[model samples]
Target: MNSIGNIKPFLQKVIRSGVGRWRFFAATLGLLVALVIILLSLQLYLNFNQLLHGKANESETAEFLVISKEVTAENQSKKNESYFLPEEIALLGKQPFADRVGEISSTNFIVTISSFSNAFPFYTDAYFESVPDEFIDIKTEDWSWKQGQVNIPVIIPSFFLELYNTGMAMSQENLPRLSLEALQAIPLRVNIKHSGGTAEFVAHVAGTTDRLNSVLVPEAFMQYANKAYGYQESKPPTRLVLKTLDAADPALQSFLVANSYTTNSDKTKLNKARIIVNWIAGVVGIIGLIMLLFGMLVFTLFIQLTIAASRMDIVLLQTLGASPRQLSGYLMGMFMPVYGAMVMIALLVLSVLQYGIHQLLLQKQLLVSPWLSVYTLAAAALWLLLIWFVNKRTITNYLKAG
Candidate 1:
């Protein structure tokens, strides 16, 4: 302790004089440059990854369907075709179905339609006129189907008018008529008798015989039309849609499938890929941090070597009663300003870059992800530990070499 106290003034003089400045300056500059390059590269990589994820989400949403069924698993294999639900179910819960499921339906209808000419106003006009003066009662409409709705809208074929060659022009609103052109045809309409004593509406129209003449109406309205036209009342669909649950979470998914189900997102591969990319990013980050630490180590080592090589100067200080610990403190203190500045600058630049990225990707619904935070903090800690280890080792090496 007395030796260290005696060494303090001599060690302080050496540092305060700022000897061998150029080499250390060059090494520090090199570290800063490397940090800039690494940060830029990582930012670019994550941006590209985010764009890819967005496109994948869009594509997957477009191509799947859903089915909800109540039958047991044994029934799925039964050869009875009557119990088999339609293979393609449209959007589940909105129109064709409602917005409930996410599939397309395969059922199609064909029919011929004739307008009432002067005998009938246009179909659109006819329907519009039926509404009350101040208030209107109409079903919400959509071009596609989902599930969970009581009624669904249908799109009529565009070729219907051309095929009939019904030269007579009629109300654009009510130009076409519907009917069965052949026997065994699914009724064009179904009659819906509300449980009320007398109220009823015509709903869904099944397939017709002719393709060009088909008309589309709400499922409920078609039923009412069948009854008004003396056809049998539309019966409830005998079959329900079914689909298999994937094995990943078979119990819960299977139960949901039994009730109302659609295609499940297969996220195993996606999750695996995410882990891999993050790991790679982490590795890259670690490498950059390692390089930074190595540069710092090299700088410390270079300073220590320069001091050791100037043995005559160290001996002169020793003659002046300098102690080892004070020499160590003196050497470390020489770089204090540089270390502090480097840390502050690195943190400041990173904060600005991250803030800019956040602003740019905000509207894209992009996020850094929670895991990114965890990985980043872990990386920083690892780098700090590496730096500390390297710093200590450099000091020890200098003392031994001396």
Candidate 2:
């Protein structure tokens, strides 16, 4: 405390001069450079992890494992040969790597789709399927179904939408191409027919998924419809959706091969995308490290020059009975604010940048996760410690020579 008081007057006079403060401000620039790199590094790390462990059904990281019985002569003898036997499904459940396995329950009745608020413009024969909600990636408040509610919510495959727009809509001039936004706006009607009669329900498009190649209804709704309209009450599902811990898990492929199961989508493509993302992130990280190294070098050189410029003042203070500890404390007080200011400035800039990025990603229906604030704070603290260490060492060495 006394050391701060001793140097207050001199510090105030020196700080008032623009020329004298130039060196300090220049030192802050190095600090700023270092901070920028660290901020970018944190961002790169977050993006890498998001892509690496992204959802199985997301566009950024598409992961769908649809397993069905392999096409074989022996199995083709039966009408519905792809069905997994009860014991076979039980054995699959025992594997440690399989996250969750759900049956793809098909509607045992017929479904007819039509549009309201417009003429009966198009017609298509469609079947509905459902799985447990846990296997679904796109979560929405509207993606739900109850027994009494007439309106049914459903998810459609992305490729089917593309096919409709490109193949059917393009060829027929009278047919209108439907965009996701447009489809959600106009209401739809779904007719579920049973042996007894037909029931019409209002329908809407909740969302779209790249994984499931079928129109999906809620699990509860599927169960209700099947019970009401199904010819066979105790029939087993022919297709299954397996949610695994990882796409690259060796055990998954080995087990699939052993059971002669076939996949609807290629898992190898996802593995390749992950590899490409890793390479890009690694390159970004290396560039940040290089910038940080340059920052350290600039910081050291600036401190040495500043110390040499003020050598005479340090000597005179020593002659006036100011101990080395007092001089060191005084130096720390003078520079600590600059160090602290740099950190504050850097954080402010990064915060604004992060927020801007978050907004931009949101517009595209994408997500950008924030970095860990505590981790960045720890890094900044270490940087401050480095500045303090250098300041003390330079002062102690100069004082020893006197």
Number of the top candidate by TM-score? 2
Instruction: List candidate 2 segments past 4 Å from native.
Output: 1-62, 117-120, 269-402
Q: lDDT tens digits, residues 1-402, model 2? A: 346685677755542322346766664686587676666566655654554465543645435588788988887888567788878777777877577688888988888988675553655678899989878877899888888999888898888778989998899887789899887776777887888899888878888888788889999998988998876774787888887757655567778889988888776456555566556766765776676666656655555555566667667767877777776666566666777888788777777776777677678766666443566667777877876787677657756875
Q: Give the TM-score (vs. native) of candidate 2.
A: 0.52
Q: Tens digit of lDDT per residue, candidate 1, span 1-402?
A: 634555566555554433357766777777765564455446545654654455545443222222234445766674342222433233222232122332222212222222224544322211100101111112333422233333334433435433433443343444444332321122222223333332222223222212111234443333333344323343333332222221122343443455444333353234445556666767776777677767876776666665766656766665776666666666655555565566556656766776777777766777543222333334444545655556566665665566
Query: lDDT of model 1 at residue 126?
Result: 12
C-alpha displacement of 78 in model 2, angstroms? 1.0
Predicted structure 1: clash tally: 59
Clashing pairs in 2: none
Q: Listing every candidate in turn, what is its Cα RMSD in Å to the true structure after a full C-alpha superposition?
A: 13.2, 9.8
